[model samples]
Target chain A: MVQASSQVWSQQIIDDIHAKADLGRYRIRGFSTFQKVTHFDDLTFLSTGLTRFPLEGYKEKCSTQVTLGARYASEPLVLETPVYITGMSYGALSVSAKTALGKAASMVGSASCTGDGGMLPAEREASDKLIYQVLPSRYGFNPHHLLEAQAAEIVVGQGAKPGTGGMLMGVKVLDHIAESRDLPSGIDQRSPARHPDWLGPDDLAVKIEQIREATDGRIPVSVKLGACRVTDDVKLAAKAGADIVVVDSMLAGTGASGEALLDHSGIPTVPSIVMAREALRDMGLYGTVSLVASGGIRSGADMAKALALGADACAIGIGALVALNCNRDIPEADFESEVGVSAGQCHHCQTGKCPVGIATQDPELEKRLDSSEGADRVANFLNSMTMEAALLTRSLGKGDVRSLEPEDMVALTIEASAMARIPLVGTNKVFGWD
Target chain B: MVSLDAHSLSARELNQAIKKAALTGSQITILNPQARHNIAVGILDSCKIDIDGSVGYYAASLMDGPEVNIDGNAGWALGENLMSGKIVLTKDAGASVAASMRGGDIVVGGNAGARAGISMKGGTLLIGGNAGFLTGFMMQKGRIVVCGDVGDAVGDSMYEGVIYVGGDIGSLGADAKIIEPSETDLIELWGLLEQSGINDRPRFRKIVSQKKLYHFDNLERLEMSAV
Candidate 1:
């Protein structure tokens, strides 16, 4: 008798359970879920027809300039494009990769952020505008670096692993990464999930004041949060005097994260951006503090969609890695030999043996990526994204990308309509708003 | 010499004045500090600052080279992230004193609140009296010498640091172990005690990192350890 293909317990589920039982530990990997979920793809732009006049693509110029941290900062982050590179730590990526990211961001007139391991001097020197992250672990946190930064981001949580501290496996904890973080070489490092100095939101206010005072109120101070309780967290950040609120949704990528967190934690970017916008608007601070949307933001279309939903800017993490040939085709035998997985099927970033060399610290693998070539690739990707966003903005008859409003967008699905608070396709009603 | 009355000036104004005075290598004195927050913050020059009265939060925070002498009590985070400076507090200090200090010396005359010398990278914190809970918590590299009793959970999750307590210890934190001090350690402790004017040489207990908790070799080992 022929067996049925559609079993009650799928082979994937069965394999996952068996794998957990065998290993006795949850799987750790890079990037987020491949599961089909609601995202910005469920939304479509309502480009100009007869009601709105579309600008000529070649003749008319669409501005994508954005200013972040204008609320309290004397010198806010000014970018030529609304798309920026999100934080990725030095320990997770090689020094060459970090330098490439910095150089690429600088070439595009954008900002690159440092992550949990602290600042890398090469990255700092390469990038014109650098945003330093003040993580809970306080690893490599110093007043001098804080002062040197164009902006300081207080990382409350990351979208890939919310409510959990950062983890760097012993394999990647080489000499420099270890020394910069003040940890012994070849030791697994786990950062605290919470800041040692402060406990709650009230304490956060005091900490923000301290950071502002430390920077002499010159550069902006941002509070970055994973997309959990978006409305409440954004409101709290606003009240705590954060110049910018970076909302990273569950779809955001990480160098290393537990499978449990990546699959079953936090909300998606589509709803998170809407909730954050509504929160800021309700608090009467819609235009005061800038909102940066991140997580699974792949293309310029995603950037335009985010801007229409009221994000001042969109940050790309995984997309930037992809641009740097993260999962591109390589020699299948070489990939298998390095990561024990075939090319295009690799997610073993936690293993410190990346085949394409974008996420590994091993000198042999790291040498695969040339910094100048990587920077050129990143720059090309950024330029393409900017052009795509500009195309969308000009088609909407908007002079600036920031002027793209929710009225210019329509949801393709019911859930998208409700979550985005935009009208459904070929309909006048937005489920939640209408 | 520069003299400023903190009562008439805002914290920002006073800090600005202090910064300006520090530029010319002048001796600055602040009168009626009245527990003002962030007094003499971010001082980067080699100068001397004397606070005649008690100071509020973050006094001499992120100080690089200034010698800050507080005649009265200090509030939270005194000399926070201090880099190459000397902060002398004549009276008690609040929680998180000298937190994350890199290179400096902090001498507190009286007792201190919780989390003294927390995450200290490289420095010397000498407390003439007792310290509260979680003292030397997560200390990476530093030396904390307390002359009086210490609260519970001393040196919690500490990586590399030496904490010497002259009085009784309430409890040791995770991965923290008491070790017998060497002759060199005793000499160093005695020298620090002498400098802090701690004449009574109580039996000192030394705490250091266990180092085993830093990594997980395998899944089964991690599970067994967790259990």
Candidate 2:
């Protein structure tokens, strides 16, 4: 008799069920998506051969400069590079990590964002340009901080967990974190998924106006959404007076999110970007409101692909953490003793025992990461990515990164072709382009 | 004293002018307010603002330091998210008044609509007349005093706050119970009543949170039941 394999009852599924049964609790983790899905790698750039002339790499110049919030604000955020740092709160990461990210952003002439826990003074002081986040919970929100920010992002949802609220475990809710959020220490903090002030799109308009008034129209206001209903949400955000719309896809990282939400919610980044661009174009708001694409963007090639798909800029969160040595190899004994797992195999950010010290508040563990060293590493990573994107732009015979349009790319797979609205390789047929 | 007419200027221009005057600590007064919304919103400086007529939504919202006196009624979210200021409404106020206020004093001389003082952090809300349903809903840390009767579901899902009612309360919300007021609470209530210029002080019942909600054990049970 031949041995049989069961597809319905896989080993991984059985292990997961047994783990849940033994623990009697839902699993929590950091980062996102170990499952393979459609991504930017499925698309290939059509470099110059006959139709266009390629620029010289060393002598010729391809500008990477991008400006956000140009439509509404008197002072828009002008970035030297198209890459920006996405929001990651202080409670989720150590102060040293926040400071390092801020310093690196300043060094690269880009903007760093504050997350749901509010602005950290050290981050604000280190960064030359900062975007403040106003989340649904409004934790640690201050009108003065809004005035101080260079730009503001009104967060409707996060990519990893779209409909659910945020959770900070008791271990992460230390005294300072609790005080900042105005909650008691040693208790789990669960933030509401929806804003208490407004209910729908019309109310969102009023809230946007209120924020505009608060800032005296000096800074731009952006609306961020999880990539679920990309087209309709983008249209609504544009109509609601958003100067910029950020689409965070399912591949985005989180500090502390439920396992089910991270795996099962929101859409993929590639299709989300295409849908958002189409929506804005249909509404005649493509150029009026700048679009930012984020979630699982790991390299300069990905950045270039997103820009070609109509994103004015790209944001990186987990990639930035990895650049800051989030999973760097350490001594196995130390890793095992501290986190109960090897360095590269750890995802226990909710436990607050991060081995690499990038996502922890413990005093001893935090001391392992030096702010200057971390900043230098991140700055080098960003600079290299920018260079790669410039190379890609020059090869496509484009003088500016933003000029590499959708016509200059082709999809390697049918699903990618359908989702990105581009023609598949060796064929003139563009799927789903009707 | 500087007087401006709301009918003559747009809301933006009027607010800019008000901010300019407030920078020098001027006594500003407005005429024909005509239920204008967002009047004097986001004012950060200390100034005395007198509105002769009714105002609309978010009057004095995000105000840091200012004394606003509204002679007529106010629309929804009066003094919402106020920080270190005082708003005195001489007539009825609309729903969600003083919602999410951080630190300030909001006084309503007449009835207040539903959801007053919702998610209040730290402030004093004194209602001279009846308060509608869901008063002090999700209150974090603040003091709400209703001199008149209160409607149903007072202090719903409240985490930590103090609610005092002079008249009858229709129903207590989940995780809320009537408790005896401490000396400090009594003194605070009396001071608020005096500041609001209410002469008749009825015997008030204090309501506080039972601290039952917001635990992981309860949340796990809810998740299990849902499954």
Candidate 3:
């Protein structure tokens, strides 16, 4: 008898099709992509032994400090570590989660971004340096808030749903969330894909100027693009006078998104950084205009690999949330009974019934995660990540994380070799590219 | 009144000068404006600024409190994201006039380019002449008074707010419908026109959001079962 299951047609795929057919809409879920793309794990650093001596972990001072957006703004973002909390709005993540992220970043002398939901007052008060985001939705967009921000990030798009805007299910669009966004309660919010004022790149230049003018050029302005056409987008963003350009890859996390978009759209982090770095290099603006990478940055190894590939700094989303007990099963929550999936497999943030308190709007669920405790956990994770990156940098005989360049690493796979433009391991040749 | 020559100073220099001058609530005038971009931008204080010639993109944008009078043709995004204050344009204005303006008043004496008053959150935009395409797109609140004809898809995807068109409507946008203006609404609109010093008030037609596009049509199993 023939095998009932085929290799191409997995049960999960079949289930997805059935669910879509029944629902008459694309699947919606949280977290990032499940696509097995080449990532930071595919690159390995060539640590020093004979060519140079490695720095001692106990004695050597391997600085992880990075300054971003120095090209235009008088006051650039100064951080002790490269990793900062990326934008994940209040509507998407609970207030407790935002507060914890802010508190965590402040504890580590890093920055926390106020994502799509505008600057939550609680987060702003908790965060020492907050990146105020200007999204297409313009929800709760106040010029007064723009004045108070350390830096401003103009969001062109997100990696999870590249072409589309933010999606918050009606369940998550509670009264306060709706009130902040100036929308009616219980309406499923779909943010506009295009900015209201500016249209194209030329217009974006003027818009950047407007932002600079609005803030008196005191803080740097960053243009955050969902990584798709990385080369051209990066060039355009730089030419448009962005102080920093953030390349958010497909692996970036989201609160809620159409499952099709998460799985199908955008490029992975490995190639995106290479393309963006080369794009800036072509314009002779590589180091002049800062490049920030955000996507599936999991550990210190990933951060170190990305820094070596040309990312000045890295922004994290899901990893930080995980430290805040996002998917963890606590004693107060029942994953199987509440969300139908176990703690590790659940992606039900769109449902507003999160098993962990990080992603929900419900009062009882939000109570499960203590902001102060979550802050401690996240700060510990950040410290660990910074040490890991610094450890690898010192291993490469480097005193600073920024000194770890592409020549210090090689790709483990042929796909990675081509995408990262680095030589393959044990081979001088870079595969698939001359 | 202090006057600065636009040709002599750089864009940065001119804006900085304006900011410095606006601090003292001084009335200032710009000479040889030359259609420069970002003129008198970020002026937060309530002061009078007169531009002698044409202006370029983002003219008088991101301002909180300043009454600016542009004497010639204006470029795109005139008075964009204005918090409070007023801007009067004497000639044709480019696209996205008063775009995303939260509060205050903007009066364009001539025709306005496409996307005039797009995504307007609050305040009043009075276009004395015709307006181009997609005017008042995604407008959350406030009033747009277009005295002359409007191009295609006017009031497209407006969530709330009333667009009073005095002349012909090229066509209506998705989820936009024209309705007879109430006497009180017309009286209020005409009163605003009178305040802006526009003499004639044609037969005004009010366009509003049908409110059908507010929410999605369907939901998933988890969404349906969610609390």
Candidate 4:
């Protein structure tokens, strides 16, 4: 039997369908039919095509270019950048992963952040702009590391597991992590959820001030807050004098136990951004402070969309692993058999011995990853994303990401459109728009 | 011994001037500065310096190599990240003191704050008075001496180190061992304090980490299972 192409249509069928459609009937007497176009004059001389969109386009004329990327938050003490690397402790990954991310960040002229564990020599060496994280664990936190990083962040919370401390079990807490964090090798090292001095917002502010004092004014101090009530918490951070704020969405990666991940706390990406923006706007510091969005940023499109939605930059965690060959090259069946799940159901990364070894600290397995190659791949991915963003800007008839307005974006579903406050396609307005 | 009176300048001015000295590679002494936080930050060099007043937070953060002396009370973090140098605090210090010192000496004349010498790798901390809670919480390698009573959880979760408390210790850390004070402990303490020109010696109780603390508790239990 001959196969029929989906694009194929007969003349009789086309005519029958056209006759049944009211729009087709209405188009028969449209204004374009009244216009005469010759090869010399071209189709441009149509009578109905005399539309003036001001100069260039509606957006170029309506919107002025404010700053793009994250705005440095002086109060909450975070830097200006839309994208940042999430915290991947030294014990979680081998030296290769840290070096790769650091080199990639340096190549891209972006910042690389440290995790709760402590400062790694390779990470510090590779990163040009390093933001050292000081968690309740105080692993590698020292006045020296703080000064070396040129910036400091007090990790008040994480998205995966809130109201609980972080546990770097003895298995993962190897000799180096143990030595750096000053913990014995084989026992579980628990980083308390709350700082000894920090009780709440008010106390947290004082502690932040103390850290700032500890480091001197040279290093900017920032707060990494997990999204609980994004608006309220961000507002508090702003009021508390954080130079920048990192909004970790609920969908962000976690290096914690399943019980902590499922039982504790987290908030989705979209609403988190909305509330954070609202909080900044309410305080009249929306444009003044930079907001770095983390969690579930898969592609450059996602990055562009987040930027358009007011994220300074998007931070990636799992995607970074994907770039480092987390699930690549393995036989699909072997991966399925070994992990006891198909590639599609592979969320068992919390277990350090990932079949691909991307999350493990084992030397033999970790050696499978080459830092230079992995860094190049990550760089290539980031470059591609930047190119995609440029193309999106070009499509919208704009030059930079800042020109993207809420009007330029539309969501696929009505609820999403409402939540994002963008117009639905063909509707030309928001859901309740007049 | 260069006598530079820092009392003539404000805390900010004094720090700027002394840090400028570090930049100029000048070995100078700061006399009676009574300086506050952010003193000598970003200064990594080898110089002999002295301060005669109570200093504030991060006295010598990431201090590379310079002999620093605090003649009075230090607010917090006496010699954080002392890369290679000597710091003598003649008075009490605040919390997280010497949180992660790589190589250096920190001598405290009075009580220390909570989590003092938290992650000291290679350094010596001498506290004349009591040490607060979680002293040497995650100590890797180093020597910490508290002349007076220590608070709860001394050397909790320590990796490896020698801690000497002249008075009563609240408790040994999870993996820390309470060893009898060794002569080596007294010698090191005496050497550090005496080098800094203190030279005061008192009896001390020694504590060190039991290497087994680093193993995974659950994994160890599983490993011990008989098939």
How close is every model to the real structure, measured as TM-score? 0.95, 0.93, 0.96, 0.75
Stretches of candidate 3 above 4 Å error? A1-4, B224-226
State each model's CA lDDT, in order: 0.87, 0.86, 0.90, 0.66
* Residue range A143-185, candidate 4, lDDT tens digits: 5677677567778777665555566555566677676666666
Report the error of model 4 at residue A214, Å.
Answer: 9.2
For model 2, what share of native contacts is present? 0.14
Model 1 C-alpha lDDT versus the unseen true structure: 0.87
TM-score chain B for all models: 0.94, 0.93, 0.97, 0.83
Tens digits of per-residue lDDT for model 2, B1-227: 88999999877777888889999999999999899777888899999999999998788887899999999999878988888889999999998898888888999999999889887878899999999998988787888999999999999877787899999998998888998877777777777687678887677899998877655553322122121
Give lDDT: candidate 2, residue A58: 49
User: What is the C-alpha lDDT profile of model 3 across B137-204, one tens digit per residue?
Assistant: 98878889999999999999888888989999999998899999999888888888888889997889
Ranking, lDDT, top scorer first:
3, 1, 2, 4
Off by over 4 Å in 2: A1-5, A22-25, A331-333, B130-134, B148-154, B166-178, B182-184, B200-203, B218-227
In terms of TM-score, the best-performing candidate is: 3
lDDT of 2 by residue, A255-304 (tens): 88889889988999999999999999999889889999999899999999
Candidate 1 chain B — worst ten consecutive residues by lDDT sum?
Answer: B218-227
- lDDT (C-alpha) at residue A85 in model 2: 93
> How does residue A73 of candidate 2 score in lDDT?
90
Model 1 off-target regions past 4 Å? A1-8, A331-333, A432-434, B217-227
- For B1-227, candidate 1 gives per-residue lDDT tens digits of 99999999977788889989999999999999998778888788899999999998888987789998999998888988888989999999999998888888999999999999988887899999999999998888889999899999999988897999988999999999999888888887887778777787767889999997887645422222111
